[model samples]
Each structure stands twice: as C-alpha cells, then as structure tokens.
Target: MPASGPPDQGEGKRRPLTALEDGYHIVTTLGSAATVLCATAFPIWLSRVRDNARALSGQSPRYARPWLYAGWIVPVANLWVPRGIVADIHRASAPGERLPHAVNWWWGLWLAGMPSGTGLMYAVPTDHVIERAYRQVYPLLAADAAVVAAVVAGVFVVRALTAAQRRRGVDSVRARPTAEATGRA
Candidate 1:
C-alpha cells in the first residue's frame, strides 16, 4: 500500500499537502479553474455595459451579445473581434476624449498572450523522457503565466471602460424603450 499522509514534515510537524495523494495537483487545478471562471465573467459584464452605454448614446453595438461570447471562444477571430468590441465601447463612451492607456495595454497583452498560451497548452512531447518533460514545463509555465496576466489585463480593460462610461454619465443599464414609449406595437 502507498504510504499514507503528507510526506516529510517530520514526526511531530504537520505534513505538507503533497502527502495526500493528488492533493497538490487537485489544488492547482481548482485554483486555475476558479481563476479562469472568475476571469470569464469580466467580459460578460463589460459587454452588457458596452451595449447599454452605446444604446443610451444612440449607437449600436459593434457586435451582438452572441458575438461577444463567440469572440472569446473562436480561434483566430478572437484576436481582433474582442478588441473591436472594446474599441467600439470606448468610442461610444469617450467620444472625443483619448482612451485611457489601460485600453491599449489590455488589448496588446491579450493579442500577444493568447496565442502563446494556446501554443504552450497544445504542444505535446514526442517522448516520455523525464528530462524532456521537465524542459518543456518552463515554457508552458511561462505561457500559462502570460495567460494569467492577460486575464488580469482584461479586468483593467473592464475597469477603464466602466470608468469611462461613468465619466460620460452612462453608468446604468438603460432599460429598453417600451413599445408604448416608442409609439409602436
């Protein structure tokens, strides 16, 4: 049987988490999953704001709500479509003002990091040699790190846009005009 309990914390000392079978991997996986899940919500909320702000300002969103979700899931198109969405939101919200530097930085990180993250995540080793796997881990780690950074940048993008909308006095989700209000059935 496999030795039970955390390994090598000394007899009286508490064992490390790794002592539990798969504990470290499970924790890491859960952390990564939670981080990605939280990151996913940023765009959804931002898109709602983007469209609402546009509608309030008498403009149409660059893409439909579905397109915003698609932009994240689609491969090559993700690179530009999402960026276009942000740019459109900025144009609508800020009008003549210069977009905050955060917008450009967020877009740049996303454009660059996403491809790198995908490449690293999808690249597989030809051989099972331990050394090769160890060597590969560094680049994979770097790419994953970049992906995390890009996720953080996404939040900054949302913040800047949200702040811009506030500055434009477009802070609320302006309700759609009713049929009666618009004089149509």
Candidate 2:
C-alpha cells in the first residue's frame, strides 16, 4: 500500500533517501551508539580499576566523569552525548584530520534510521505476517544485542585508526634530531 500521510518538504524534499542511504544510516547509527556506549563504559571500568589499584597501594582512587552516567539516563542528552563522544573519538584518533570517518557514518545512520525506525514502529501495520513477526521479535534482547555488537564494531574500527595516527605522531616526534647535535660543524 502507498503512504497516506502528507509528503515531507524538508531539505532535499524532492525525494527521500534511497535504500542504500537507509541501510547506511541503520548500520552507522548502530556503530555510533555502540562506540559511545563502549567508550563511556571503558572509562568507567578503568576508573574502577584505578580504584582497585589505589586501594592495593594505599592511595585514594578517582572517579570517572559523572557525565558518562548522565548520558545513559537523560533522554535528549543521550542523543547529544553520543555526538560529543564521536567528536571526541575523532579528535583523539587524529589530532588535525577531518572528523573521523566513524562520525560521518554515525550521523548518516542517525539521520536516516531514527525517523524511519520511529515511523515504522508507530505506523499502523497492514501486513499480518510482518506485524505479527515484528511484535514477536521486537521484545527480545537478542535483536538488540546483535544491533549493539555491530555498532560497537564500527566504533572500534574508528578507535583503532585513531590510535594508529597517534602512534605515527609519537614516532615522528621521537625521530626528530636534537638541535645541539644538528648544529655541530
């Protein structure tokens, strides 16, 4: 059946994104969300590690940023936090390069997937089999776990690339000759 609602006239109103764009968005959004969750979780886990180390050494441990916890609980903030996390990931990955590829991927997915997912979820389902299957599967954690894993992998790839860049930067700095030695005549 054809769509019944009024047409969308937003930017690029001539037409909506193609199927490729929709797939890209879904995958990217999943990756971005996974990355953000992992990044935040890793830091918190490290903080716990720090606390344990400190306790073993008879020193006080520092806590992880409270914002990490805040991001998970707050609604609007959750969206914005992921963006910031991705930006930070990009920055951490490449000091001067354009935002990491993951950031672009995340934005692409989020822009396309979010609205589509919301619409698909809310729109009255006409197809019996699809509606029944969706209802049956949607509530299961397995579906969410698969999505989460894909997203996390996307974030991980970005992180790996960034770490490589940082390593190169460090190596170049270490390779530079001392001015005193270079000036010897």
Candidate 3:
C-alpha cells in the first residue's frame, strides 16, 4: 500500500482561521466580557439607587431589594420587573409627577434588541454571524440601532431620576425643623 498522511489530517481537516476571523473572535470575546461586566455592575448600581429613591420619597419599595438584580434574570418576571423597578424609583423620587418618557423608550428599545437574530443574544456561531453579515446585515444593524437608542434613553432616565431624587432630598431637608425652631436646643 502507498504511504498516506494521517486520515484525520487529510480531507476532513479544518482550515486555519483567517485574520478577519481572528478579529471577529476578538470582538466577540470583548463583547461577551463587556456584557458580563454590565450584567454584574448594573444590578449593584440599581440596588443603591433604589434604596436612595425609597428613602427620599419615604414610600414603600415596590419590589424587594433582591429584585433589583434578580428581576433581570428571572423569566417572564424579567419582562416587567426590571421596568417596574425603574418606574417605581422614578415614581417614588417624584411623587404625583408623570413617569419620564425616557423610561418607556429605554425599556422598549432594550426589549426590541433581545432577539437572537438581532441583539446581543446570538444563537449562532461567530462563523455564522460573519456569513450572515455578508447577506443579511440589516438585522444586525437594526439591533445595533436599538441598543444605541436604548442606551441614550437610559441615560436620560438616569438623569431624570437623579434630578428628581436631588429635588426630593432638598425639599425633605428644608421641610425639617431646626433644633432651635423645635425648642430642642
């Protein structure tokens, strides 16, 4: 019999990744890392803000402290819990005021970006994404747009909430009677 190369390394052997493929891998890795970081950090920040809002408004917390983090991961509950948490914060911070439009926009865009074909949740491999990018880039672009819009709206929501909290805090402080006024001096 004639000598032959290893069967495993012959016709069925995998080709080396191209530079572009390597770049895609790097981008995917970075994106996953960023997602993880955000996933971990956002809950902590939200928890703190939720506490502050509750204190400022002196209203009962609509959701428990754990929900600040758990709501994002729980199925079905995630659909409304996270939004409710933010809404509660805003409502508490600015009682009798309308909820900020940015809150609704942010949540809507964020939900719109969650599809596997479009948003951060890619059900396919990187190779598939690259392939799809060539033929159907619009879905990817739309997803990116949704995420970007969500981010902008989220910033507005945070700003509105912070400003409302600040105003509430100041008002509370001002409403308190001084020791002299209360004859406690």
Tens-digit lDDT track for model 1 on 1-185?
12443233355664333333345346545756775776577666866777766775688886888877788678878778877888888888778877777667777766666554433234432222122333466654666676667767777877887777766555457735545545676
lDDT of 1 at 142: 66
**Candidate 3: regions farther than 4 A off:** 1-13, 117-124, 170-185
- Model 1, TM vs. native: 0.67
Question: How does residue 32 of candidate 3 score in lDDT?
Answer: 76
Over 1-185, each residue of candidate 2 has an lDDT whose tens digit, in order, gives 11422123336442354454456457645755665776667555433323333333343323235644665446777666645554553344344767655555654555444432422333442233223333564533344444444455556545654354434332122223234435643
If scored against the real structure, what TM-score would every candidate get?
0.67, 0.37, 0.76
Please list the C-alpha lDDT of all candidates, in the order they appear. Answer: 0.63, 0.44, 0.72
By lDDT, the candidates rank as 3, 1, 2
Q: TM-score of predicted model 3?
A: 0.76
Error of 3 at 32 (Å): 2.0
Candidate 3 whole-model C-alpha lDDT, 0 to 1: 0.72
By TM-score: ranked, best first: 3, 1, 2
Best by TM-score: 3
Clashing pairs in 3: none
Model 3 per-residue lDDT tens digits across residues 1-185: 01322212345573455666678679778877877787777676677667777676677788987888788878889889999999998887788999999999999998887763432455666766765665687987787688778878988987887777666543232234335445575
